[model samples]
Target: MNRRAFATLDRPYKNKTTLDLLNSLAVMKFSKIKPLVSAFPTLINMNNNAVNCLIKKTLFPVFCGGETIKQTIPTMRKFRESNIKTVLALAIEADVDELERKGTDAVSYTRKMVDDLKVCIDGASKFSDNFMAVKFTALVPPGLLKRWSFNLKKLQDHFELVSTDGLLSRSNVSLVQDAFPNLDASIFDKCDELSFSDITAAVSIFGPNAHQLILNDPLSVDADDIETFQLLLNEIKDICEYAQQKKVNLIMDAEHDYFTPAIDDIIIGLARKYPQGFIYQTYQMYLKTGFERMKRDLLRLEKEGVAMGVKLVRGAYMDHERHYAKMNGLASPINETLKQTNDQYNAAVEYLIANNVPLFIASHNEDSIAKACKLIGPNSNVRFGQLMGMQDSITFKLAQGGYNVYKYVPYGPVPVVMQYLYRRAQENREMMNRLDKDKRYILTELKTRSLFK
Candidate 1:
């Protein structure tokens, strides 16, 4: 191994010049709008065959390793030789039945991938850097989980209401309004004849005696909702433990605020159980409150005496979150401006490094990556990560500069690949109104490459 590239580490990425350049580029308006206008239509109609065609041809090649395991090999090999780590994910997201079907598919696919990567790692110990990443929503439907959570809250509120008094007060009405804001006027008119228990029984979707309602898409087996989630956890755990034996990492992708706490708790529990090798918990830096949340988690972890592993992202669901909040006249989770997000991202990176916690700073932003590299010192555990296709220049250059870097390499067929593609397109478009640094960096790279020729 040529250690020369990895040796000249300190004082290499620390200069403030590129950071300032990035700041100027990031604040410009036209650089942001161009990509937005181009990406919006494709994003809005993600299900369109034409869009899928484009995704398969252009974006997939850029953002994903490939559509199949065999296809991912070459890309994986290239990264392996370069000493860049890889996190392979079978990109699948759909409704309940489809998600469950794909969960089985993922298990089968991951086992094969694990076997292959193990061989590669064994053959060339320092070469292969492959791990597995999966989304929770890929194994279970998001809406079903949402409905389950909603029903649970409703039952709790009803319990409180009945225990208080015979009359339903404003707070109890608020609870009902929160769950079913579109409650029928006719339903309200008939409430006068119903007692607390009668109303509770009437409102119950699965009858009052049952502790929980059947999820929108009920499980085929005797697996309860939490049990089903536990099964998913067990599958990932089985794979993670196997991979750990082979020196591979497993990461859980983050979801929306609604379900993230449950998922976070699960990941944290796993991290505690397998502290030496298993690292979990993901952070979305694009959220307005992301920094605060990270700080809170850091304190909690410190108090609990557990190591924290995080996969940091600029987030992808800002538009949908904002749109939903605006429609419902509520606050959104997204940052107020691009500067705020970038600042927090940088701060969070610094925070992680200061605590000496291992982190994966998965992003395409040059300034953010540069800042992280500077903060990492000579030999640190921070890894720079990027999606396979979107920003190879940064990924390659950072890896070339001797920092540990990883590519989020996703693989699967077209149908399952669509969800990953949709998110990539949406993320690019959403950031278009926010950050211009990536576009500007690309333009600079193109100019430099032309000049070199």
Candidate 2:
């Protein structure tokens, strides 16, 4: 690939103010401190005025947009001035216990979340360069999501065991039942009514065709779980419907694997209904099977004429996922190495570019972004996204090159987004180190100008 375009990495920061560079350096420098990073979340949450003020001045400005849409405007305007767009997302998500504690009040909590998201969508509607992002974890109970995922995986496993080598037709229902003698009646009916012989390649690529049934709207969750699942689905549908009316685009943010399968199924279900390009799904490439999932979904969406968008990322939950798997004695799903991840990421990028699908390349890696640009050339269908505070150079360089660039801006109260900011701090250290040479170049330029003084 011709890598000449973004070779001069120094060019990325040419337009950044000296203060911007210094602030970025501070974010990395602070993150590198083991103790401070460790204490950050607890300290921020305690309402300690000094700690809050210091973090608000430092990491808050560098990592998050602001506490609310009104507060987020200045940051959004600054990005707009630089020819970059903003993917605005709220900073709250619910845990399993939180929902169970709420019980029927879960409905009230979801309604409140829906309102908050609509506010974000309205905010995005006001700015042509800004779009909104929402997480399913924030919309419903995480426990419920796990319930749906567990059942889906069980169905997928059963289908895989009985699935034949050749084309799978409705007649294959016998095979599935023969393998799973006491399969649920609902699943059998769902299975008996569906066939994957036509969408062969796409279905086969992703293993069993059971989950594909979710796309067909024949979801098979536990009898007790169905009611709550429908409520969550309806909540998402309401938020998405509002976004569509406003002509605002929505990207569904991906969480950890526990909720991802259900998230993916819900997104495909939404896409089947509103394929007008309003809903985009995220793919985390660090997962070993991430690329195949994206490829399979893309093929199916294409064949079914469902309009959907994709956001590609290397993933964020490596440490947590691995730790959880080890504790539970389950195999880790994350790719074992960075190179494995990068290879999968790049392949997904190339595949999207080759197919001319609308994609958001959400990364700070210079090489990956440059490779995507090479494949994209002058294509406007592909957009490049980086976080708000990190990777200033790469973001600006893409904007300077006249590519579609976006900054993923998280907006919420500092205490509320403490977890997000902390995660950003941890993730930023490695990437910032890689950009040290660029940092020195920016510093040298600063010393040469009185504007910096």
lDDT (tens digit, per residue) of candidate 2 on 216-300: 2233334334455555556778898998888888888889887786777778777878988768899999999799888877777
- lDDT for each of the candidates? 0.59, 0.74
| TM-scores for every predicted model | 0.66, 0.87
Give one digit per residue, the lDDT tens place, for model 1 in 11-62: 3212213433333333333224666545645554566777667556655565
For candidate 1, the 10 contiguous residues with the lowest summed lDDT are: 7-16
lDDT of 2: 0.74
TM-score of 2: 0.87
Candidate No. with top TM-score: 2
Candidate 2 least-lDDT 10 residues: 197-206
Candidate 2: stretches off by over 4 Å: 1-4, 8-11, 14-17, 41-50, 101-104, 166-169, 174-221, 451-453
